[model samples]
Target: MRIYKVGGAVRDRLLGKPVTDIDWVVVGTTTEEMLAKGFRPVGADFPVFLHPKSGEEYALARTERKSGRGYGGFTFHASPEVTLEEDLIRRDLTINAMAEDDQQNLTDPYHGQRDLEARVLRHVSPAFAEDPLRVLRVARFAARYAELGFNVAPETLELMRQLSESGELEALTAERSWKEISRALMEDQPQVFLEVLRACGALRVLMPEVDALFGVPQPEAHHPEIDTGVHTLSVLEQAARHEQPLTVRWACLLHDLGKGLTPEEEWPRHIAHEFNGLKLIKAVNERFKAPRDCQELALLVGEYHTHGHRALELKPSTLLELLQSFDVYRRPQRFEEFIAACEMDARGRKGLEQRSYPQADYLRGAATAARSVAVQPLLEKGFKGPELGEAIKRERLKALKVYKEST
Candidate 1:
């Protein structure tokens, strides 16, 4: 049997990138032969094994044919006769279809190296359309390598468009879609992933609320980009550029869903879009069953981002109300996350990316000042129950007032 390194390991190495994991394809090998050689069987759907010593994945070279619908509708064929080239061709992208031999000799039956050099994300074969998941995979690759100037090949994009229109995208499970989306959100250019999906029409099927924002106009004075969807992407880009964590980025992504629901006659003025966005954010969170932290932050940003923008102009009582709304003493980090997402939203507009957002510091200082109010002193003053709560609020409000005056 001849074993060759395949898939991401070979592709990453060819691109002069660090290879994180290696997958081996064993050609001219049978399942019985592999079992005899001390490899543990692990693949439920096909012939995959874990090497006894290295513990890396090793699959017998196999080929599959579409037998039904969605990702599960496939029949696999693996045997000693299955060639390495056949296995490679089953990959989703040309850049990922290259393999390398034990002697480090490269195999390029599909010219993956050429596509990689050209910075093109091309599908390996027509079979790429067979699996609906490839649409998300292609978009994800667009996000991952966007900094390196990689773009989706026209033909591949057309295939994605066809899949999107065929309703095949709808057949994907929400969990699978979320896996792609969450990973894409953490990419260096997460907006590109959404943009590519939107371009291919998959956004309507997967994230219709986000898709609805595309033609929706925002107040031009506030959002020079005009289009709510464009502004959303801009905010997501800013979030990434700021190196914000995934929770903050996720909040940035869903913060403006309310704008999409604004009445067209209202045009650019979405007076209550902040509150309007709350239900949409909750819907997205429930659809994907997103992490509780991500859901909470998105909800908080959706409801209070406008308050965050107007933080510096608020009265002390209003400022205290906002700070209390976050329950900052219990989860101060969430307050920081909320500020980061709001900063991204404010900076997301055209020509405002580098502008200062003092509101963040203002709110942060307000939170700190309120936290510094002594609860022990209030209790020692013979306060209890509702009176204790009332006294603490009064003290925190006073502290906020002092902070506001100092500023």
Candidate 2:
């Protein structure tokens, strides 16, 4: 068997990036030969084996043909006769299709190295349209390599547009779709991911709420960017710039969904847009099966982010209500994430990215003051049952009032 390292490891190495995972393609190898050599069979749909000593994956060179719908619709054929060229042609991008032998020799059947040097993300073959999942994958690669000035080839984006317009993107599984989205959100240039998806018309098919935001206008007095969709992407960009967690990033992405639903007569003023956006937020969170923390933070940001932005101006009672809604006493980290998401929203506007968001500090101070209210004092003062709850609430409110006054 002739072994060659392939996919991201080779691509990243060629780009002078640190390779984290190594995948091997074994050409001229049969499943029985692999098993006899002590490789552990692990693939369910194709011929894949685990190295006996290294524990690395070794997939037999294989080719696929699109037989039906979605990404999983493809049927694979792996045999000892399968050539390395045949296997490389099936990859999603030209950058990932190159292979390297143990002797450090390069194989460039599809000109992946040439595309790499040109900083282009090109498809290996016309068969790129076969798998709807590659559309997301291509966008994600753009997010990853955007800092290096890499972009999707125009022809590749045309194919992506064709896939999106074909209605195939809707057939992808939620789990698979979420995997690419969440990864893209964490990239150094995540805004590029959403932009590429929108450019290719995939955003409308997969996330219409976000897509609808493109032409929608916001209050120019507050949002210099004007476009709700542009602001949404800027918010995600700010979250990434601050190295935020996934929950905060997810919340940032969904924070302005209500703006998309604003009436045309309202134009730039989306009064009660926060409440209008809650249902859309819930739908998106449910669609992707976001983690419970992510969902809760997103919901809180969706409904109360405006309150967070106006923390200094809000009454103590309103501030307390917001904190209580977040269960700030139970999940402090989530509350921090909520504040960060709000801060990103505030900074997302053009020319305001560097402005101070004192609202976050005020909210943090309010939470600390409320938490400082001693429950032991109330319990010792004959408080019990619902009365104890009321007593604690009253005391917390009193502390918040004093804190707000002092501030």
Candidate 3:
């Protein structure tokens, strides 16, 4: 059993990044041989084994063929005849293609180390386009490494463009697409992914709902022609600036996706846009195979504006009741995230110079205050059954009245 450290672990170590996961490549080893040696078999399409003690994954060195399209269109071969160099050559990026032996000997036939030093994201070979999933992976990598000044190779970008144009992107499952997008959103600079996707024409094909937002003018009150896409990007940037959780960031990035489907005539006054966006957000969640909590957060962001606007007029009891309607504990960070989304959206308006109301500051301060007051004894009286519920309800109403009178 020749064990060689491979992929992200080696790349991250070279880049001085934290290594969270480790993958091993076993050359000249069969799955049956691995099983006999006490490794637990795992992979179905590919031959991967789990170490009985460490639990780290060890995959047999293999090569793939694109028998279909999208993520599921591939067949893997892990026979002893498969060479380590051939396995590395089939990887999407050069930086991820390099491997290191148990004794720390390096094997980099693709010059992945050179690209890593230069901060470039180059394909392992011209054959990178064989797997359509590589396009999304490259775009995601661009987002993650934007701070390092990494740029995708021109040839690689061209192949991505070709794959996107050839409808290979459409073959990708929503879950696969979401996985790439989710990682991109979690990056410090997610706009890089969007920019790369736009350049490659993949954004429009893969997420046409979002692509439709480009250049769609907002009300004259919005400066810089803030379309849905621009607004979404702005929200994402704001979320990143605040260093919010991943779910919040994703919600902000996709908050206004439904605005594109709204009629052009209602551009700025999209009163029902939140509801519309929620449907699209749910569809996206299902497509991407997001967890239930994540879906809730995304949907919450989609309807954040409505909730914030309603909060302004709600009594304390009504507000608490409304807040209690959600599984807030399961997503403890959502309140802050909702506020962040609202703040970004409000600030991006065009006619801020002409507006009559203090919408931005009001939304910010109100959301903040609501969060603070909702934790008070009156709001959290620990009531359970009918009597407890009634008492809590009474306290909430009284509190709301006092708040309204003070305002």
Candidate 4:
């Protein structure tokens, strides 16, 4: 049997990117043969084995037939009859279909080398639609390679559209959807993925709440001609450009989803959109099966704008009390994440930068100052746990009182 390095490791190595993981396809090897040779068989649905000595995965080169539906409904064939070329032909993308021999000799059966050189994401076969998860993977690849000027093949996008219309996406579990979206949101240019989904009609299927943002009118005083959908994309683009953390980025993307739910007539006069937005964010999180921590942070982002507004109006004692109430020391990134979300929200609106909103600036400054304060030092002092807690509470109240009187 001949072992061949395949997939991302080969693609990434060719691109001079850091190769963090390696996947190998062993041709001319049967499961029983591999087992006899001391490979640990691990795959339940396919013939994948782990090298007993190297601890790296070594999958038998196999061909697949669509026997069921969605991602899990596939029958695999692994035998001496399956060639390395046949194995490479079944990959999702041409760039990922290249293989390397043990001597590091490159094999490009489908001009995958050309696609890689061209920086294009092209499907290896028309059978790519057999697996719905490939759509998400292609979207993610587009997002990652946008800066490199890579574009998905037109025919491949057409296939994605067919898959979306075929109801295959409906078979996806909430956890699987979240897994792909979470990774997409974490990309440096998430708009590429979002745009792809939008083009393929998958966004409407996978995340209708976000898709609903498109074309929903925003107040003319605050924004340009774009609706809430366009504004949301703008905010997400800004976050991606800034290299913000995943939570902050996701918050920016979903920050304005509530606007779609709000009445257009009350656009400029609405007073509780943040409150409205928080509920919507929670619903969206639960729909996507976001973890508790993600749900809480998303809710925080929805409420963040309101909190900053309150901070601006509060007196020093109340402000301090508010700060003290939150365990900012332990969850220090929380406030910064909130501020980042709010900044993107404000910047996302047109002419808001010139509008008189000193409250945003004031609260942002306060959060920054609060972060530097060593709250734990006070805790470490002779003050007992209850005393320290009470002292902090009293100090915060005093600060709020003082700020209110001064304002």
Please give the range of 10 consecutive residues that has the lowest summed lDDT in model 4: 349-358
**Alpha-carbon RMSD to native, per candidate:** 1.5, 0.9, 4.7, 4.0
Q: lDDT of model 4 at residue 77?
A: 87
The residue-by-residue lDDT of candidate 3 on 49-73, one tens digit each, is: 8998999999999988878767777
True-structure lDDT of candidate 2:
0.93
TM-scores for the candidates:
0.96, 0.99, 0.82, 0.85
Candidate 3 or 2, higher TM-score: 2
Candidate 3 colliding pairs: 221-350, 221-351, 222-350, 223-350, 316-400
Reference-based lDDT, residue 400, model 4: 46
Candidate 3 segments whose C-alpha is farther than 4 A from its true place: 220-225, 265-271, 306-334, 344-395
Model 4 TM-score (2 dp): 0.85
Better structure of 1 and 4 per lDDT: 1
Better of 3 and 4 by lDDT: 4
Best by lDDT: 2
Please, what are the lDDT tens digits per residue for candidate 1 over residues 207-295? 89999999999878899999999999999999999899989999999999999999999998999998998999999999888889999
Candidate No. with top TM-score: 2
Candidate 2 lDDT tens digits, 1-407: 89999999999999999999999999997999999999999958878999999999999999999999998999999998999999999998989999999987999999999999999999999999999999999999999999999999999999999999998988899899999999999999899999999999999989999999988998789999999999999999999999999999999999889988898998989999999999999999998898888898888899999998889999989989988998889888888999999999999999999999999889999999999988888888999999999999998999999999899
Q: Model 3's lDDT to the true fold?
A: 0.75
The candidate, 2 or 4, that scores higher on TM-score is 2
lDDT score, residue 353, model 2? 98
